[model samples]
Target: MPASADADLTTEFERLSLPLADPFTIARGTTETAENVLVQVSDGSHEGIGAAAPSTYYGETPATVEAVLPDLLEVVEEVGDPHVRQRIDRELRERVGANPAARAAVDTALADLAAKRLDVPLYRQWGLDPAAAPTSSFSIGLAEPDETRRWAERAVDEGYSILKVKLGAGRTAERLAAVREGAPEATVRVDANAAWTPAEAVAKTETLSGHGVEFVEQPVPADDIAGLRRVRDQGAVPVAADESVERATDVPSIADAVDIVVAKLQKCGSLRETRRVAEIAQARGCEAMIGCMVASNATIAASAHLAPLFDYADLDGSLLLDADPFEGVPMSDGEIDLAAVDRSGTGAVEVDE
Candidate 1:
């Protein structure tokens, strides 16, 4: 388990299709299934696992991730050192700048492997305190007002106190009202997924404020920084930047325009970049939220390991699955219990089907 600059490593990957517990709909689209690519790296003794849940919104699909993973894994093997994660991440970025999810799979696998070598959980490897991690929020994908109410009620019954309700244009107010009616005491947040114009966003925030909405995420389109600023300047509720902020460098540019920067591991390319995004968001006087796509624990676990650095977390990706192929971090009542991760590495391992 000792570190080696000239270590020998092997890598491989396979496709992972996960069925959603319910058809997940957002403003952009609906998903009954999630396509992911699982990446594995080994040093003959220990194997590290990770998966990429590619999103078309980010311009990457399972096909794209599968196509680029070989090249990305080649970078990992070429580096020949699991501990030199920065170098592997750098080369992966230099090799393929577009497929952040693909690069993320490789980087996560390597991090898991390296952490295994050190015999410590990833958060411990990063010198983070488990208790500092914020509670994660459960998501309620866009559905009918009655159905949305049922989802909220179910979530509350399952011990989730925080809810992230996805909203589109039609019947949004009714849906949120149902959520409130169902779980009146639960903390509520809404994500428009950039489905609205600036004016529409402002109006929605006014309406959402009445429903006790904590904030609105990606109210306007990704390219509309001015629209974001307009909403922030005029809306009753504060705004969060999800599509608007992709990486660390992006945070500074959009920081003045929004109240929160949402960082996802796959979107940011690697764990390091996601951390950088968090740091920059904090430094820029914006709150940081760690989020993830509808993914398995393979990648979500690694993302959760960085939760101590963020002000908010929406890492219920695996929780939304009908079942997950891999197991990683465990969430209880929405709190990502990093302290419970006794296994070395990220605690992400494929379970028997």
Candidate 2:
């Protein structure tokens, strides 16, 4: 691929749905419908796909994400030269402003296109070693104890060895106990989505810790950095920063408070920015987890490329979708089969017309 081809990149967007059996809820609340933002980049014959989902936590809706697409595309079109990819990557962070999920659609699509042009797998492009990829934790949304147990049992039956449960609606203890009983052999964890106060988080963590729960995610508010540190100090269970640590700059302040940093592609703007955040977390001796925003196969593929670079991964958003557009990355037995992506870029298959 010649550097000149970089200047010819173009983008497009589409919307898709999720396949979850029931509504999924976290500390940010619940959603019955799953809407995703798909980004497609084309340079003559070869094309690449990327995906993202609007995050209500960032005040983003499908319409808002779509509205930002044109401007993001314009930025990608104007930048030229070999560094065009890197330049477009930087411009996205600057002009795109906030809304990582929106920017992620653009950045990931462009990266996919570039990778296809170079004929290389996205992970190889990022200098990641596939053998080092981390195991991803499959998620279990909130529900009645019996229902939650059923879901956990299904996940384990599906061959998933690690599970992350959504807590904080009510009956926290009972809900967790049900998951344990359901998936007795699997490693279990929970995320409260910042639903508790520091004291409440500590109390909840202490209670859940007795059940062999691995760790808790964002128990308190994101802005409560000090509160998070306190929770971390008080519990035997480690506290991971999800919403609190979005940008790379936030790393230093909460370095001592979090044992793990969850980097959501949508929350961090683009894959380039997401990688930077991961680098920062690693420097601080904190483990990195690459998460998604309830996206589709396109976006999930982009995230999967970064999975090998982190300690934890939760890229099951595509699997939850009712109809994912692209193919390539396969989610089975609690792991994403990335063998197809060995070639380059997103390694995503074309969306059916």
Task: Give the winner by lDDT.
Answer: 1
lDDT of 2 at 300: 81
> How do all models score by TM-score?
0.97, 0.93
lDDT of 2 by residue, 240-291 (tens): 9998987788888888898999888887887777888889999999988888
Q: How well is each residue in 68-165 modelled by candidate 1, as lDDT tens digits?
A: 87778777777788999888888888888889998888889999999999999999999999999999999999999999999999999999999999
In model 1, the runs with Cα more than 4 Å from the true position are: 1-7
Q: lDDT of candidate 1 vs native?
A: 0.91
Model 2, C-alpha of 283: deviation from truth (Å): 0.7
* Cα lDDT computed for each candidate against the true fold: 0.91, 0.78
